[model samples]
Target: MQIILNGAATEVADALTMAELIEQLKLGGRRLAVEVNAELVPRSRFSEHRLAPQDQVEIIHAVGGG
Candidate 1:
């Protein structure tokens, strides 16, 4: 399946869940925010949030600043 990830077109496996994508990105231990098709997806729901083809996904990582 194809998806728009962080403003770029990318292909992912069929029936891939948000949690799996996060693991694939190697961000399992990082603080981040995810938005799908302009809708925010809570972290608690990542495991159940399945990604669809052509879905627009935005992943923003949190950075600590002084």
Candidate 2:
């Protein structure tokens, strides 16, 4: 399926959930926040949130600064 990820066009396998997508993208253990279709998806609900075609996915990773 095709989805917009971080403002870029991305194509991923079918029937992927947020959790699966994270793992698929190797984002495990990273401090990040996810927004789908202008809605914030809680970390706990990652496994439950299924992605659909043309969904907007924004993953913001934390950065350290002094």
Candidate 3:
């Protein structure tokens, strides 16, 4: 399946869930926010949110400031 992740086109396995995607993206830290198709997805729901073709996923990571 094809989906747009963080403004890039990516091909992933069929029936991949958000949790899988997160791991694939190497976002194991807790300082990132995930938004799927314009909606904020909670961390607890990552495994339950299944991704479809052309799905838009925005992952934003936070940075420490002085």
Candidate 4:
């Protein structure tokens, strides 16, 4: 399957969930925010939010520095 990740075309496995995607990207356990097709996906729902082909995904990591 193909999805637009952070504005770039990328290939992923079929029936991939948000949580799995995070792990695949080596981003698990990090503080971040995820938006799919312009809709925000809460962390609690990452495991349940399944991504489909051509889905627009935006992943933003939180950085704390002052």
Candidate 5:
């Protein structure tokens, strides 16, 4: 399956959930935000939100600086 990740074409497994994607990208347990097809997916729903092919995904990580 293919999805547009952060404005770039990317390949991913079919039936992939948001949580799985996060882990695949090595982003699990990090402070982050995810949006799919212009809709925001809450962290609580990451496990349940399944991504579809051609879906637009945006992942933003929170960086700490002081």
Candidate 6:
């Protein structure tokens, strides 16, 4: 499956849910928002929602600045 992550195009295995991607990418507790194909993927739904091919994923990690 091909997906454009952030801005780069990459290929990943299919049947992957948002939560699985997070773990696969080793993204833990980043305190960010996840958007898949123009739709916001709620944290609670990440585990259940399956990502499709060519889906656009934008994960914005929260940054602390003063």
Expressed as tens digits, the lDDT of each residue in 1-66 for candidate 4 is: 999999999999999999999999999989999999999999999999999999999999999899
lDDT of each: 0.97, 0.93, 0.90, 0.98, 0.96, 0.88
Report the C-alpha lDDT of model 5 over 1-66, residue by residue, as the tens digit.
Answer: 999999999999999999999999999999998999999999999999999999999999999999
Candidate 1 structure quality by residue, lDDT tens digits, 1-66: 999999999999998999999999999989999999999999999999999999999999999999
Tell me how many clashing residue pairs each candidate has.
Answer: 0, 0, 0, 0, 0, 0
lDDT of 6 by residue, 1-66 (tens): 988899889788898888888988899777879999889988999999888888999999988999
User: What's the residue-level lDDT of 48 in candidate 2?
Assistant: 92
**TM-score of every candidate:** 0.97, 0.90, 0.89, 0.97, 0.94, 0.89
Q: What are the RMSD figures for all models against the true structure?
A: 0.5, 1.1, 1.1, 0.5, 0.7, 1.1
Kindly report the root-mean-square deviation of model 1 from the true structure over all alpha carbons: 0.5
Candidate 3 lDDT tens digits, 1-66: 998998999999988999998898788765888898999999889999999999998998889899
Candidate 4 has a TM-score of 0.97
Tell me which of candidates 2 and 4 scores higher on lDDT.
Answer: 4
Give the lDDT of residue 37 in candidate 4: 99
* Poorest lDDT segment (10 consecutive residues) of candidate 1: 24-33
- After aligning candidate 5 to the native by TM-score, how far in Å is the CA of 22 from where it should be? 0.4
Query: In model 6, where do residues sit more than 4 Å from their true spots?
Result: none
Off by over 4 Å in 4: none
